[model samples]
Target: MSDKSIRVAVNGYGVIGKRVADAVTRQDDMQLAGIADTSVDWRLRVANQRGYRVFAATPKAHTSMSKAGIVLSGNLDDLLDEADIVVDCTPKHVATGNVALFRKRGLRFIVQGGEPHALTEHSFVAESNFDSAVGRYETRIVSCNTTSIVRTLGALKRAGLLKKARGTLLRRATDPWESHQSGIMNTLVPEQSIPSHQGPDAQSVDPDFDVVTMAVKVPETLAHLHYWNVELSRAADREEVLAAFHSSTRIAMVRLDDGLTGINSVKELMADLKRPNDNLYEVALWEDLVTIQNNELFYAYMVDNQAIVIPETIDAIRALTGLSTDSQKSIAKTNAALGIGSALY
Candidate 1:
């Protein structure tokens, strides 16, 4: 790796953007160039307190932000000029327009999964496609749900034990901060479809991988739970499947005895451990949930939606800057730097 640090910028300073900026700051080969956001809120204020160069995402927001006592470094163009690569963490559907801007400036960028599937050259999961992302101008990190799905399936596939997989995703209705948003309380809204878009989103990352998924939005902000039933080419016992997950670096096995018997318990564990943002980066799987019958494996795992993609975003920086070509090495570095896999739960 070169001695020079990669200058990285974040376009949005919302939920994911703040985490990405923090993750970038922790990396040895990357620096947080600045963050751009349209609004002047607690998120931007926190970015300022953390000593990040804050930029205005839109021209009109500048005057308002200045009025709100928040100092602005420059506009979006200036931020693009200063950054080696930008991670677009804008909310879902907001990044479509920014793609053309990045292309116009000839700047390499990483976008979140909320963007369209075709927005980038490829859908990136560091463990599955890190090498493919190197030297590419645009890389899209799959959504939190998609990340959980792909990691689970990818591990089984790598073991040559996966045939077909079907899952039900119990999604959180809103983020912890989005209490004012509709559907944040007292609801379990199902996505009235046989197979939700998340399965197809996962397939976009690996066309050969087969999975069918259904989703229901629950009124909790902790995590998204996935219940999967996978068919293997050959018969495998529960121990064998659990062993496969244990061998994988990105997957974390949770035992009942560990005091993480439920999703809320996992969150409490993060709080007790004093994890930043109470983040659990690894895919958390229940030890007792793994079962096998007639070559079919059934298991349940939880994905910390807000934290799952932070490491992937960090890996994207490595890929875009040609800093690291090996996914294992990149993952190890990120996990160690951010305390990802060290949590008790």
Candidate 2:
């Protein structure tokens, strides 16, 4: 919209896409160039209502969008031509096919977690590797669970207390809106393998991190809750461990004493706070539960699958664009715009 702002276009209008669109618009130095989507539904209409020009992602979608009464602004290439960078939020593996098209225009692009890390050969978590991705062609923002793991463990790693970590995750079966059509009930399903993909993915962001993860799909559609058993470098008091966690703004402490008994309650708390889309973009940990004894630390935290990566993606945008050279500066700007800090604790 102005000569000074970065033009950011979102290539999907689903859970992450729409949120990214809103976040790009809130920034003082970034502009929401437009959003491109193949869906010709209420989602597109909302983008239209919010004044984001809707571009059909395919020629077939172009005609259907008109028949569905969702006005279109040319096609995907048109949106790409106007954007300095594109965040591809299309469904899993779908973004891979678009890589050549983005390169044809020499545009910087970001792909979601469902994409493989090899797609960019660089995975990003704002706190972990923003500097490494600075002025790069692209990067992958690891999945929500991996983002939380990296944020929490990276804090400990930064404090010089981390040794290695083992984590167990209870994952939400599906997004809440689609829970009625999918997800398990009266049953729990576990990943067939130990030390799941999240463990290796965390390595993508920070190769020095020694972590292992196991996950299960639970019956609910609220959020993913993680239980961690970490070996610290030395025997430390709870205060020392908490002090390390306190250093990271993206890691928020929520207490059971505060009635946030689990993920659903945490989600309710975000809604009560009137956060946009009831988004909890931080790692909501139970400060009181964090305990360290004789070099072993145990704690648990909640991760909003749909929201945790939004800030990281924003930071990646700055990193790729060279708009902010320092991770803290870009993180601070993103946190301030998204309300991503400690007031809740």
Position 257, candidate 1: lDDT: 80
Report the lDDT tens digits of candidate 2 across residue range 239-259.
889999999998999888988
Tens-place lDDT per residue, model 1, 91-159, is: 898888899999998999988998887878599998788888988899899999999888889989888
How does residue 322 of candidate 1 score in lDDT?
A: 85
Q: In candidate 2, how many Å is residue 223 off? A: 0.3
lDDT per model vs. reference: 0.87, 0.92
Model 1 pairs in collision: none
Which stretches of model 2 miss by more than 4 angstroms?
Answer: none
Q: What is the alpha-carbon lDDT for the whole of candidate 1?
A: 0.87
* Candidate closest to the true structure, highest lDDT: 2
